[model samples]
Target chain A: MSVKLAGELQSGNVIIVENNPVVVLKAQYNKSGRNSAVVKVRMKNLMTERISEAIYKADEKLEGVMLERKDCTYSYYAAPMQVFVDSEFNPYEIHEETLADITKYLIPDMTDVCEVTFYEGRPISVLLPKTIIREVEYTEPVVRGDTSGKITKTAVLKHTKHELQVSGFVEIGDKIEIDTETGDFKKRIA
Target chain B: MRRWDLFCRVVDNYGDIGICWRLARQLADHDGEGEIHVRLWVDDLESFAKLCPAIAPRSPVQAVGSVEVCHWSTNFPSVDPADVVIEAFACELPLTYIAAMARRPTPPVWINLEYLSAEDWVEDCHLLPSPHPTSPLKKYFFFPGFTSRTGGLLRERDLMSTRVAFDAAAEAVFWQSIGIPPRGNEDLRVSLFCYENSAVPEFLQSCVEGPTPIRVLTAPGAATEQVSRWLGRGLVTGELVRVGALAVHAIPFLSQDDYDWLLWSCDVNFVRGEDSFVRAQWAQRPFVWQIYPQDKDAHFVKLGAFLSRFLHGVSEPTVISDCWQAWNGRGRISFAWPNYVANLAEIRRYGEVWACQLDHAEDLANNLIRFVREQV
Candidate 1:
């Protein structure tokens, strides 16, 4: 167990609350008017897969549940669980509920190495690669004089059907790099 | 009676204790169904005494009205946790007290009552729960705000009606009570309560050179000192120093109730921090706020958020926003003052409209009661 301030805690970090190990899916820190700050987090329980949102003082000390993580590749998806295989072909089944966020970016046979976190050797969550390149399945035609990237329009990803904002210059079938954590367009692939 | 412990640590100004005391008194007065016996635990009683004369600084425990006030010492007393616990402004609760709370059969409804902000994020974060890491306890984050989604501003039950009933005769009495002569209609009366800022001299200079005769009442301590520095002379309580059209009077530090009266009596109010700022709004007067400055100019964002809400539907919002920015060290008060003063009538009328609009929000104390009832 390791101690971390609530403000320092980030996504993919597992924290112990009420004897349960919960992985943070997202964290947002906001400074109050004076002398204090607050951190709001969305987390999911490793054992029960119970998703919950909580707020904590930025300076609040929290116990982090250290978990073993292994680099793995997405192999397949069983009915209620997504399966990942390590280099040695060791299969780990993570609940589909736990993949609620990363599922949009998950693709079988993807070359990126995803990190699989385990508690007591039970696979809990998968951390996607920091940035992912995906082809824009569909978007409007490029608008004139929009090369400055000030304007943005929604574009749908090819395989995942995930729609995200892209620069106005981006057109259908254009590949863009997206920040996996925020799901924001990083840059357009030439 | 359902008991509550409101813990407040006075960091620098009286804003912390002022707000806590107001909430405690309001909660004590408006115990809707069951009695909510509020105990305000303050670290600095000397400061608390300034706001409420009834508070005995040396006493360990004393009752002021229905609320019980306790001196929160470094050596904390071993007391049972209340049914509901509020740590005001994120002041950490004593570890021993938290331990006692954890021992309770059904853990107390713990709340970290945050500072007031008009920012959009406040609504999303308000009333959210924070589960304790090791203990079987949860604390909720309650934020006071201008909107209905967030816990509203602090307002006493009779505050509005009381202000409305304070007629010109009552105003004359208030002036006499404060050692000031009756205010003439020609003199634009303004109350100044703020932290030290670079804009003070410029503001004072503007009043001195402006066409309108302005009478500035500087609240004791920092505000008075600032005015004195600008005057190149020390100020004594009740001493009026005249410079051109600007006449500055240094008033003694007043009780919380009297301070509210000061805001109500003023044509324009300059308020700082949390408590006085809220009171200025309830006063329904054209006011300039100097938000408690933070590192990296973060407070400007908060000020902008409030200005956006306050300036809604107003013609020429910059007239107010510019003066506010200048007062906050962003622009020149000399340039903004003319625009601000020229529109005082419009601003004053809008102040009434703004206060009435804010009235629609649930009062902070009542909001806490409804939230607590739902939880415990």
Candidate 2:
């Protein structure tokens, strides 16, 4: 186990809590006024499969449980489970429920590799690449003179049907780069 | 009855001890729930003594009123853990004391009492639990705030009543006690308390040159230091320095309750840091705040968040905003002074409305008790 500051905690990092390993699904850092910084996390217990939310002082120390991970491509889903094939064509299955919010971004046979995390030799969580390019399936007509990206409108992604906010300059069939971790629109891809 | 151990480490100024002492006093003096026993452990008793004169600075262990005070040291003694433990302002708890808490049959409810903020995120973070890295203990973060969704600001039970009861005779007596002469009806009574800022001299010069006479009651320490530097002499307690229409009176350090009286009597208050800032709001008087500066100008964002909520309904909020920003070293005081002074009567009436709105929320001490009870 390696020591990690709570402020540095990112999605897919597993840490020990109450003698149980929990994978962080989301982490948010906020600092206001003269108050000490804090990190709020949404995590699920690996052993108990229980979801819980917690907050910690930004500088708080925690024991990070190192997990084995492999770069893999998303394969076809099999009902309750999602399948992935590693570089050596090794197949691994993780529960669709465990994927949480990431399920909205998953597309089969994608070129970009996703990370599959293993805890005690058992597949647990999947972490997507930092950025993913997806085409807009539907959105309102682009507004003129909005090059600054200050104006935003919701757009539906082509394959996943996932809806997210995009710059007002984007329209149907426009490819956009999105930050996978935050699911926020990054930039318009030519 | 539940017992609570409150640990406070004075980082620099008296703000830390001032807040901890107020919370500790209120927790101990609570009338209901079988009377909780509170023990406040402070590292700087000298600073604590300034707020409560009864505290013996050198004593390793002592009692002030119903609450016990301990001089926290490197060689912390072994003692049984209380039912609840409060780490004020995110101060780390002694490892040994934490171990004692873990060893207890039922571990204490650990809480990290965070600093006050008006930002929206405070509500989202308030009352969230943080599990210990190795131990089984969990500590919750409690934030003091102006809104109901967050843990509310600190206010003693009889504070409002006491302010209401303080009449003109009482105000005169308080002025006599502080060794200040009577002021003219036209004179604006201002209480100044703040940290080091380049804006201080300019603000003082503006006050001196202004047409209206302003009686500036400067609190000892930072406020007095600023006045002394401006006068090019050492200014002591009870010393009065006059220039133009401004009369600066250096007052000695006042106890906590007396400080409340000072805020109540003043026409305008210039307060710094957490304790006095919250007290000035409770005083229901027009006031200006000088927030403790933070790295990379982050404090400006905090100041804006508070001002947005504070000046929500005002027609020309910039009157207060510009003056406050200038006082905090953003713009020119001379430019903001005219508009700010013109809106004084409106702001004074607005202060009463704002205080009434704040009073609707549950106070910090009671909210803490409720949150702890629900958790434990």
Which has the greatest lDDT? 1
Model 1 stretches astray by more than 4 angstroms: A144-151
* CA-based DockQ, model 2: 0.63
Q: What digit string (tens of lDDT, one per residue) describes model 2 on residues A1-190? A: 9998999998789999888999898899988446568899999898988989899888888999989988889988998999988988888988888888788888766787888999998788898888999889999999899899999999999888999999999989998999986789999997
Q: Write the per-residue lDDT of candidate 1 for residues A102-148, one digit (tens) a residue.
A: 88887667778899988789887788888988889899989899889
- What shift in Å separates residue B376 of candidate 1 from its native position after superposition? 2.7
Give the lowest summed-lDDT range of ten residues in model 2 chain B. Answer: B177-186
Q: Report clash pairs, candidate 2.
A: none
| lDDT score, candidate 1, position A62 | 95
User: What TM-score applies to chain A of candidate 2?
Assistant: 0.85
Q: Which stretches of candidate 2 lie over 4 Å from their true place?
A: A32-35, A142-152, A167-171, A181-190
Q: Local error of candidate 1 at A38, Å? A: 0.3
lDDT of predicted model 1: 0.90
